[model samples]
Target: MNTLDLHAEEFRQQGFTVFRSVLPPDQVKLMRNLAEGRYRACVADPPDRDTLRGGVSLMRAFEFGTAFRDVLALEPVIQVVEALLGDDCHVISQNVLRTPTGRGIVNWHIDDALFFPFFADLNIDPKHVPVYSLNVMIALSDVPTDAFGPTQVAPGSHLSGRRPERSPDLPAGWEPVSLRAQTGDCYLVNSQTWHRGAQNETGRTRYVLTTAYGRRFISQRFYPFINYTMPPHVLSGAGSRIERLLGAHDKGPYG
Candidate 1:
């Protein structure tokens, strides 16, 4: 069977699916280098809004002007997301996530529920969202169980419709599962699934880029703000789909 069908079936049953080595090694290396460089630059001088109260969102990241976008636009990932969401899918937010060693763990939460609060506010059922939200996590390093804390997910938690209560143990063999992935592997998860970034016990920090996708009708975060002074490619197509998804009509030059 095609990978997209495989992923959809897995997600339907398990609430999560891992695509091993979806990204080629060369592309993964380039993206990882680009992400690190962007991270360093953001650290040295951050935009006013990016200023953090504590640990820099632990997930603060950049999207525009990187080879990473090529990966985001990959046909395999797109097909999988489209299968899960629908035909008219748009890119949501693509951001970097970092877990520093010795730091505390991030809270367990669902992506769609946290970002799109209006679903609950408007009293709209999540089942009717057109395109179901899906989070595509591309691993940037080897995350093992003992050393690097990747992510802990409660399998089948999306169906629960609420955050699963955390505990040291569960009734059956069903406990929070830690996702340990290699550099080029990718994990596709239901946006409503319960999960969190586990603590990084390794001597260094862990990095991953999270690209979110949703049906075209739903709004999106992280609209691209391409710099005008940059090259034509950067400024022309800035925020095309993002603007539409966010329900705005501010078209860019390319748009």
Candidate 2:
């Protein structure tokens, strides 16, 4: 099977998959530098508006640098995202997640909202997975070991048709899998999957460029919901794909 098919299969059954070496070393370094700069700035002068996910996220990060927008339409990753969410998919959320040492999202939870609570009592077909939102995690910093605190996810937990439990235990033999990634590695997760950031045990900090995509109907969340438009400078030389990912859409319900 082709690589896209493989990713589709993995995603359908496991709720998440990692694509190693999806980015180059130089690209990774550039993104990491951008995140570091933003984090430092946030620390220096807090923004007037509240930050998402507490203060760890550099909100709407893609708007800050070229590399961020460039990575959004990456051919390989886009192909997989489109194949799963359909060709009309658009970016719903994009931000840089930076976790400092001795800090991380230790709780397991789903993204956006629940998808299957009403169907929780029924049997879910393994062959068919209903995916709404997808999170593309680009590793800007090396997460070479558990100490570095890779993203932890429970395989197939998304098919549970319910929210993650208040306790740590999962159904059957399911256990959290640490995605020990390296700089430039990219991993995709179904937004409904049970996931959390393993605590950063090492002194090194963690940086991840997160881009969330959704079906055409899913609302775009570029923050400030109203009166937010893509900066003309950012789209000065961008191609059609980039434009679409940045919220360009042909006539829809509104029209």
Candidate 3:
């Protein structure tokens, strides 16, 4: 099988898969620059120190600039997403998540809790694959060690159809795996998978750009109606596929 086929199969069985160095180094550098610049600008203002200390999450990033939108249209990345979600898949949310030094741990949880019921109702088996939605996590900075708080995931836990218990004793067969990636790597994760952001003890900030996508029928996680509007230049320059992915073609209630 080809690399795409292998990734699809791995995603079905493991609930997540990583594509190493999927984004160009230059593109990754650009994203890192944008995120760092925005964070610095935000920190300069009078916002409390608490805001500056933790993860800096910027939502509706695609609307912030063309570079953010450009990442959404990256051909190779989109191809893997399309392989799993089909050609009609559309982005539900886009954001840049930056974990600053000494940021506390992000507790383990599923991306969308609503999906648990759907999985249970359907009696989806561990081996039975479903593609409701996914989050494309693009690493904009090197995450070389635990101190950087790389993403920790419990493989195959998405099949549990619920969040893993907080107790020390986990469900049988569940084991947490910390994902390590160089700048520009991307990980495609099933929205229902049990995962968390580890504590950042590193002195430097870790940057990640996340874009969530789902089949066109799935309701968006954020306000699609107001967030979809982009600058006239951006809108005019976007292809039809990019427009649909950006929620322009969404007719769902939230859209």
| lDDT, candidates in the order shown | 0.64, 0.84, 0.77
What would the TM-score be for candidate 1 when compared with the true structure?
0.75
> Which lDDT tens digits does candidate 1 get at residues 1-255?
775777777776677888888777787777777666665666777673352225433222334454654555555766777677665566666776756787534577777554443443354443444337888898877786646877777886666545544533343644778888988888887877777777777887787778887765556664333421223443245455433332344444446
TM-score of each: 0.75, 0.93, 0.84
The most accurate candidate by lDDT is: 2
Total clashing pairs in model 1: 0
In model 2, the runs with Cα more than 4 Å from the true position are 47-53, 166-173
TM-score of model 2 (CA atoms): 0.93
- Model 3 ranges with Cα > 4 A deviation: 44-55, 116-127, 166-173, 221-228, 250-255
Q: What is the C-alpha local distance difference test score of candidate 1?
A: 0.64
Candidate 3 lDDT trough over 10 residues, lowest sum? 46-55
Q: Name the better of 2 and 3 by TM-score.
A: 2
**Candidate 1 lDDT for residue 124:** 47
Per-candidate total of colliding backbone pairs = 0, 0, 0
